[model samples]
Target: MTVQLRHLFALATCALLLGGCASNPPATARYDFGPLPAPSTSSQIGTLIVADITGPTALDTEHMQYRLLYADARQARPYAYNQWAATPFQLLGQRLRANFAQAGVKVLSTTDAITSPTVLRMEVNEFTQSFDTAKSSQGILNVRASLFRNHRLLDQRTFQRSVAAPTPDAAGGAQALAEASDALAADLLAWLASVPQP
Candidate 1:
């Protein structure tokens, strides 16, 4: 074949190979929260209802999120093949309820006929794996919490925590996030206990 024809044939082969690789779906990995600190049955501070936590629509799914602080700090991205076993809100709510029980708080469901005297509502503002630089990353968790009694607002506060990842990959991020989540839950329960009951 002529030299020009040979070059064209080589380019076509490369494109075909690359296209095939690109077409293959990447492997997906799922993650979830670690075992919670066990439930508490001894203390009954008061019956409290934990309303479903709300957050940005983007976080309403099971996708794993990360922020590129070194590039555009405001931009959040999801891993193409990595996802949470459950959505962040669901996981957070589950952990928080478990923590409250462990703390001797009587947690109840809103639909129960005998309603709790107090209600805890929360909204998650930030939940992601943030990278300060290419070599470092951490799981960040921020939440806005509100307390209510007899349908009246009592207090509101925001909590934020960050835990460093053991590695810069999804597994590391998952571990860091679980730690941060547990920490946040503990803080919330402490804050609730400090609030005076009417």
Candidate 2:
């Protein structure tokens, strides 16, 4: 073959190989919940108001950058292969409401009737996910919460736990986050149930 023809043939082969690599599917992540534990029983159905989680505050500075995955400056990251999801504040609020409902607590919106004497307000201080090098790109989720009623402090707690992604890929990281969120919700419910009603 002439030099120019040989060069063209080599270029075509490289293009095909690169295209195949680009189209390859990301690895799948697995999530497992061991059991569905019963919700805590409450004798009185109290009005629990879940305010929209407030923050992206200075408290969040520590974790703000952690959620972003490393990427090349020129190449934008792929959302389909990225672990980005609802903000932590939104996720925590949703999970909290679900847990309260499962525990037989009556959740009230801000405008709901105030027949119930007590109100529960929560402030989230920390919600972060980061890669753990020891576990080969596995990630960890950490959350902190505080509770109040009628502008007086009721309770405060911090929750931190690590979850392992199925692989080093983004899908695996997302799965790990879901697992962590579920576990946190369950724990939060249990804690709330244990608290004595005023």
Candidate 3:
């Protein structure tokens, strides 16, 4: 081919390559529990050890999961372009610790120094955003909370929180889930107050 023809072929090949790259999917969106209140320095109660949260294998992933109750309620689906910064189990634990600390309750991790302290352990039963209709949805969090003292179970109960989504999409689901987590934390704190302490 002539030089002019060869140059045109090279330009077309470069254009095609660039177009292919442009067609790639959008960047993934990562989310977290959002901003937190300043941690309190006062300790109304003794140091409390928060054990690592436990949950099903699915909850152990960073995927932002949801359920189409109006369609297939039994199947959980993950967002294609959105994800949590960490697993739901880890995010719940962090949120709980933050909330407790902000409430003037001393919070410690399981890895921290051990004492005959009050302990809080949680197991997530279900965590997902459920769409009841094409335009309505809510975030649902169900967990089993157990309080321990001196390695003895002081009290145990299950808590469930559901918060409506402002929108019917992933962004709304994340916000709803965050609010539901806060609600769950508040409930746990109230329950601890009413339970008989050792």
Ranking by lDDT: 3, 1, 2
Per-residue lDDT of model 2, residues 58-107, tens digit only: 43221222343344322222334333335556655666677677767788
Which is superior by lDDT, 1 or 3? 3
Ten contiguous residues with the weakest lDDT in model 2 = 59-68
lDDT of 1 by residue, 81-195 (tens): 9999999999988888887777777787676665677888999999999999877999999999999888899999999999999999888999999989888977777787789
TM-score preference between candidates 1 and 3, better one: 3
Sort every candidate by TM-score, greatest first. 3, 1, 2
lDDT of each: 0.87, 0.57, 0.89
Models 1 onward score TM values of: 0.84, 0.59, 0.87
Which sections of candidate 2 miss by over 4 Å?
1-45, 57-85, 111-128
lDDT of 3 by residue, 1-198 (tens): 999999999999999999999999899999898987454333346568999999899889999999999889999999999999999999999998998888877789988888647889999999999999989999999999999898889889999999999999989998999999888877887887787655
Highest TM-score scorer = 3
